[model samples]
Target: MAKNSALIEPRLPRGFVDSEPADLAAVEEMVAKIRHVYERYGFDPLQTPFLEYTETLGKFLPDTDRPNAGVFSMQDDDEQWLSLRYDLTAPLARYFAQNYQDLPKPFRSYRQGWVFRNEKPGPGRFRQFMQFDADTVGAAGPEADAEICMMMADTMDALGLAGKYVVRVNNRKVLDGVLQAIGVADEGQKLTVLRAIDKLDKFGPEGVRLLLGEGRKDESGDFTAGAGLDPAQIAAVIDYVGGKVPSGNEGIAELDAMAALFASAGYGEDRIRIDPSVVRGLEYYTGPVFEIELTFTVQNEKGQDVLFGSVGGGGRYDGLVSRFRNEETPATGFSIGVSRLASALKLTGNLSSRPATGPVVVTVMEKDRIADYQKMVAELRAAGIRAELFLGSSKNMGKQMKYADKRNAPAVIIQGSDEREAGIVQIKDLAEGAEAAASITDNAAWKAERPGQYSVPRGDMVDFVRQIPAVAAWMEVNARP
Candidate 1:
């Protein structure tokens, strides 16, 4: 044997994580909540392969400032280039084009999955994350755009973020028309201007003024090159973003036309507003573009209100499928940054509910009682309760209970030869044990107050555990679709 041995790898790379029960439950809750809202909006769920041919998914996302890729890439078995999808929307475009004739016209679907980008990582930014996306295929017009906006609002509400979030809407057509009016005909230059305008909220009008004209120097002393627009062109872009949210009846006239359709479907004014600032970064949008902006503000590193930026955004891309199909079919959609939203919620204290680690812990009463402990967990499982036997070997019974406490087990069941002979099993409510642990310094007082912890008939084990659901569960069930 060598004098020294090296340790095996045991940690994950940056931007990757494993969620324990406390963290995972919060994510699942939000996912279910958003999916419920999507289904209510007539969007069905969809999933696709993680890998795609690089040729099939062309370069369209602008302003990410990475190589011929922010996407992770590799070679296929035949040496064909392939890449992981950077956005859920891009994969949908590929899916639609591949199965155009088989699927219904105006095919509507919602997809939630992980995406990858090889972009630089920063605070609150990650290379791998999950997105919840929904798209309406084969629909043009503002009605589809309005539907997406409404779904965005409702989805926020469902996720307990209605009061905390807002959906800002703008028509890419409107912005494009504005650009055309400004005398920008070069297709490449047109896109550069559009992307610069999208960041108006971040850079402000003056900052955007620099992004449009010459390059602008950020406060961090970094330089960003402009899209090269003249003063006249920059002003037009500025006016739209800074424009008012026209009020009263005439103010929201264009918006009302779309809202009325949702009204008929019973979704009302609590969601969506016809704001002008929602120009997104993508050049593919043919009509409206919208973003889910968190209305609640958190201080940035620079200690300023940034409106929580966009946790998710999507818009009408009528030309995406056109690249594949001979005919141009219009499609509109929205995507939620599951990772970003999860991060914000965790920061803001919404995802703070701590659930009991699991159901019962079958304490290892003695070395000989392993079989008995295993049988106790089996009974709990049969009764629809989560449970596990104490896998750790310990001689001290007190240490076993301490282990149960660390596991956050709601209850601990113990069996010894004496209890087995009497057909009774000892059950301690760890949920109650926690409350008992926090106070009552005297061990005698602790034991006395836990009057609920006592031996029960083997047949009554399920009943005893059922009584503790309210004590251990941190979430409620809502079945309404």
Candidate 2:
């Protein structure tokens, strides 16, 4: 007997997930909807490689303790560190810098790809996930940032989240003014303050106050060393976060400017709001910062009602490209966390619950007549109908129908020896058959209803199947005219 090899258990890395077929289909649908919105705004699609030179990506994240804290990086053969991009914007910055002379100024482009982050993931957070980003590079005005906010709102509405969400806008300069007012001048202390403030949603006002002053120790007894500001400074910071200070008025003014732009564009306060609380936790944003938050609440793992936070956000980074070129090249963009948004949509019942319809299965009645089954499948497919020939070992009619049902097939094509002799084919509407089977009881009633099964000429199989409402409706929308 051959020696048994050690059995290895199949497992995914922590904070990573495997997307099944249905999950992938849902994600694709969301991407298509978002892509349509981006393209409508005249933003071109762009594809960038997943790997970038570590230096090119840069260490912009607020965590400065470890230079490579948030990113996944490894040294290449040439001893140069290459990191999987943590976000799309950084890669876009690198791309723009590399092709600065050739590419169009104010390069408006959208990209959808997987980004990796080496963070301790928890509920709704993952190590690897999809992001759809739209950026307008080389545009310096607040209007460019305003346009991004508008586009973000439109994209959310496009994804069936019209009244269910809001785009909260704020300005880093406004926050900077607040920090200056409070006398938190040091960059490290300022970042710590920003980081603490960013947790306002998770840790409410009192919790944030604790962090702002001394520090916060969670339920797990983990002490997060805070900024250690004095009581007056903490009060100022809290007041700023609450939109109650002279320092935040600059940011408030910027938000008002953006609001005017939105109003002129017919996007009223209903869609977008000037919320000073939105201190986006990114060091790169030098101007306006916005976060898209779902207004609706859903039950968490503990069955507690919780708000879905920050589906997507972006802001003006005037210095990202300037990192490469000495001259200032202002840019602004927004990115939707594809997985988070999709999951939220699903939970809220806003997501399309349409079942994943499979190809119409052409069952093989006889092994010798496989060629005939293939021909039927070919005809259906040629007419732009999704179809497949059953290649299962079981030739049992019942088992074939079961397979079709398992596939969520709209219909099944049948051609037994008797049907073939008559030069015809039987098309059973699996969808309709299942529906009728759930309701109808008697054999006579089933035969009289013939619920979804229909017999048509061999040549007319495609046309006949197309007549089925479920099949035809999908074809009309998906197939070519």
Candidate 3:
């Protein structure tokens, strides 16, 4: 056996991640746009500390059962066990109840923050991720749910997911009625049954049928024990799911009511949908549960074409505040999974990937002229151009150009011996020049390429640097999304 050591392996435990800058940038854009839409709808931005008392957040969260049960947990100075929030909705509930007297009757607010869950991370699941949510408290009708659905529709349109996305809305109570009709007495079991039903797309009708009755043998050769119900009971669950669709009788009633609300408010079914598979996982949801599903397909982890599925979801938690205030306070909210949304947008070719800055590297030709190089950099900076000086000790001109290539520099300003003698500054259109060089052609032929490299006087650096906006515009026009 190998020698034992106290040090653990250098790796992340299954569900955690370190997001890349590209990923964060796309998400940031989406979050900013969504925030603007929320603010337009009159929701104030509110923030609360990530750490809160265990009693503060309450215990109805689907995964909150015991210590370190669902969320990351730690003990406080006063010996109170605190867990990271599982969702923004719970914390908003806590915020409303604590400041009940101070806040307006219908406290409207939105928050963007990181939420944690200590659950198994699969294809699109992670231990920690960011959520953007908007909520309205003190509202007690389907109108509240209706507003959330409207916001959901607007959010998709604002994010450019308009034609490609749809919102599936349903009431948790409607599901409860289905469960009651199916004879699932316990709420927990009903939720489990709903979760299984939600996976109908993944498992298909046969798989769901097995899950409703005895159990299922999945593609991975794993057996998921079913609710263990009789044939008649299982049939009811199957029938309920089958009955849900955009243009159906029961679904049409709910959709018609919501459509009338949005239609009066200027949104319509051209973007919204009513699908029964939207059984959201949060235990706090007491009313309508809405999910934004991507109709497009993206490559899965296995490089297979799988419908990317729902990218965001939320529902009404009418009883969340009751956990603390001991009185009913109805609240409805929507959350956008920014990271997943960004990923889907990226795969669908909807997100722009332009690296914002194109550096202008001033190549140093003379070691003694370091001061002149510094002056050139200063001039570029003064003109509001992204500029830097080549710090490499290499004297070879070819190697200096290579450095600019690595930096993705769009222009390389060269005041070489020849140019210095001519009283002109040799400027290379590094972006185009580099691209030209990368093509399969002779290096000398590429180097002597006349259309790219230009010469200007030393005093004209700013004017020359100003050409980038046009270059960027031209590139944008020529490129395909």
Model 2 CA deviation exceeding 4 Å by range:
1-3, 247-253, 443-450
**Per-model tally of clashing residue pairs:** 1, 0, 0
Number of the top TM-score candidate: 2
- Give the per-residue lDDT of model 1 (tens digit) for 307-379: 7768999888888888888888899998889978887777677665575356567888678767767877887
Per-residue CA lDDT of candidate 3, range 311-404, in tens? 7888888887988787899888888887888887777677756553347889899999889889999987776566898999997888998888
For residues 1-481, what per-residue lDDT tens digits would candidate 2 score against the true structure?
Answer: 4579777799889999988767877777888889998899999999999999888878786587676679999998889999999889988998999999999988999999999999999877899999999999988888888999988888888888889899999888888988887788898888888888899999999999888888999988999998889999888878878877473365667777788999999987889988878887878889899999998998777799999878989898989998899899989998888988998889877676566668899999899989888988888889999899999899898898888888878999988999999999888987788788779888888778888788899888888888887788778768786
Native-referenced Cα lDDT, model 2: 0.87
User: By lDDT, who's the top model here?
Assistant: 2
Better of 1 and 3 by lDDT: 3
TM-score, ranked from best to worst: 2, 1, 3
Reference-based lDDT, residue 108, model 3 = 91
lDDT of 2 at 76: 86
Candidate 1 local Cα displacement, residue 168, angstroms: 1.4
After best superposition, candidate 1 residue 397: deviation in angstroms? Answer: 2.4
Summed over model 2, clashes come to: 0
